[model samples]
Target: MSEPRFVVVRNDEEQYSIWSADRELPPGWHDAGFTGTRAECLAHVDEVWTDMRPRSVREAAR
Candidate 1:
């Protein structure tokens, strides 16, 4: 049996999360183009999503 597949996703706020690669993405979220096992996806998010702040919050601070 194959392990569950996950895809990295990002919202308008630029926050990152993982979702089932085979399922429809939630509203306001888009695929970040990376797919793999849950751990792999999380690692990718961890690497890329260095800042935890949302887009608006980061922008406002600028």
Candidate 2:
């Protein structure tokens, strides 16, 4: 069987990354609930990670 192409992950800083779904996630990261090809996952992040700033920073700005 072929491996998954990509997966979306995020860290405490709320930054997003497109990781190889065939590998293990590193520390301080969790699945962002998205899975697809690298381009697809990155497109998902592009649609979702709109604020561009960390949650904390956004909250502080308010």
What does the lDDT read for residue 39 in candidate 2?
82
Query: Which whole-number lDDT from 0 to 100 does residue 55 have in model 2?
Result: 77
> Please, what are the lDDT tens digits per residue for candidate 2 over residues 1-62?
85469999999989998899889999999999999987899899999998889878988999
Determine which window of 10 residues in candidate 1 has minimal summed lDDT.
42-51
The candidate maximizing lDDT is: 1
Tens-place lDDT per residue, model 1, 1-62, is 99999999999999999999899999999999999999999999999999999999999999
Q: Give the Cα lDDT of each candidate.
A: 0.97, 0.90
Best by TM-score: 1
What's model 1's TM-score?
0.96
